[model samples]
Target: MKGNPSLAVFGDWDADGIISSSVIINAQRHGMIYPIRGQAIIEYEPAEPVYLSIRLDEIGCFDAIAILDVPVIDRLLESMRSYRARCPSSRIIYIDHHISTHEKIEDLYGVVEEPLVGYVPTSRIAFDRVVSLGYRPGDRLKLFVDAVDLMDRGAMVPENMKGLLKIVSSISKALSYKRDPALWRSAVDWISSPVPLSSPIAGASMEEIARLAAESEKRIRDEANILAISAQKLGVFRYIDARRRWMDRGASALASMLYRKLRAPVILCVASRDRRHVLMIIKYPGKAYRVVKMLMETGIAVSIGGHSSLGIARIPVERIYDALEMLRSSAIY
Candidate 1:
């Protein structure tokens, strides 16, 4: 890196994203003696650019800009390219797993991307990539990672997870009770554990952490069909909430939440959210996938492409009700 950003980290709200952002932010928060010395004027930003600029202006000029778990929007990338053309001294570091591109996105001074699986719905590869960027992982970050994995990926508990002797043991519990459970409490605790959305150093303290995690869990359980997790935080981190059922991890969280609650039928995943009202979808497992293909065959005026299992297209919310009605008549809904 030519020079580290005065200081900033950006990622999605998922476990991978949140943790990734926190790992770096905490480095500053808890007072890590980073060999990479940042200018005291370098301020950290969260959520909004409007307020962030207030501080950035006070600092005068940012040395570098670091991007994490999330992605750089195409237009913003264009803007950066244009701005950089004017200011030759500025540099940027982008570490991300999103941004659907076959070749690595070029032009940025430094770029690192974790693979957003072409075959699997979850960005498992990307999550690991996020963790690798940290200069060193903290215990708090580790616990936060377990919390997200428990809710997002560690849905399966092993035989050893039955005893709630340890605090961070949800995956073990979930796996232990994948089918039936003598100790579902541990699994529930894991799901209920506060997956840190932001680090205590960044102002999301441990006390607040539990509450946020509980809120997120309740939201996912009650509403979303798919649930994605990340340890980073970013601007404009997108999650597809077409039916408000799809949570984050594609069809798995959807199916589990549905059946765990009432075995409700319709469960699927989409490629994009907040993207021009169109969607790319992946309906997993059973014949539900076939229903997706059937929808495209109806000659709906939209771009729909993917396998019977996975496809991409876009649809407006204005047509959402009509689409649902169509699915209702079909056997999938």
Candidate 2:
């Protein structure tokens, strides 16, 4: 596997995904400690299901593929299995922290699955796994990984980590569920650099994004406040905001703010940017498994995925009420 091995690394566009891919590629290039040796590393960061499907077609070209921090694995198992059967020498590695997909990952054949629990992000998982394989990262690298974990898990305030958390959050906001290779490369370089994180590195567009995120937060706060007082609770507190541009961006933050304040299972459906679709975000604290299982059983949500206490699903605009009824009947929320 050491001689000019072709490699493909796939991850989400979020902090965990980008950092995890960077760790693997950096290890592969140095070859001083990590067991992985690859001649060329190809990276794919898919922003949506359509893009992900397209990238899946390219998997057969690589000798090894690492899927990190990608939660929607049930849709890829068949393609992966076919690829493995076609290229018996190829290897696939999966690392994730989404608890709802544990069984699915366990079922995939001819791949290495490293599923973690609690607030651990795939970057930390990749770091530990690489170290176990004899890759010794420096103190700065470890600290950066730890900062990412804390930021992703919402475990720290803005004051902690010497302003690294703000930097990561600002960068992620600028990315906005989209893949920008150049911006991503800059972020990777910063994380892998030996210098300690001291100042914020906002991309050209990041200042604007920061302002927009602040505005969105205010709208979400007001909406969530209304829901906290008036949402209908049928197994879960359900609220739908069909206001125009309600989901222009940052739906997850809204859902999180609601959950943090309500301290109860919350289901939020926000109109999509096009107003022709709805995106659902559910947070159930210790009951994420039940909520995810219920949604799957309904067979309505497309590309559903969940971490330990939060889940997200996409639904057709017309089916929003039907989905709510299904959730109400499931009694699992």
Top model number, lDDT: 2
Model 2 ranges with Cα > 4 A deviation? 1-3, 31-35, 38-50, 111-119, 152-162, 177-179, 195-236, 243-249, 260-264, 271-277, 316-319, 329-333
TM-score attained by model 1: 0.47
What's the distance in Å from true for residue 90, model 1? 2.2
Q: Which residue pairs of candidate 2 clash?
A: none
lDDT of 2 by residue, 88-186 (tens): 776677777766446564565344433343347888988888888777766767766787877766574545575656666666655653346666666
Using all chains and alpha carbons, the TM-scores for the candidates as numbered come to: 0.47, 0.78
Top candidate by TM-score? 2
Tens-digit per-residue lDDT, 1-333, candidate 1: 454445444343334444445444444434332212443223332321222223323333344554444443334455555544554464454554432222235534332222233222122333344345554444445554555455444376444542321232223223222322212222222322334423222322333444444554565465543343311111111123444434223333443454344323333334344544535343343443355556655754253433333334345646654555565455442
Model 1 has a clash total of 44
The RMSD (Cα, Å) of candidate 1 is: 11.9
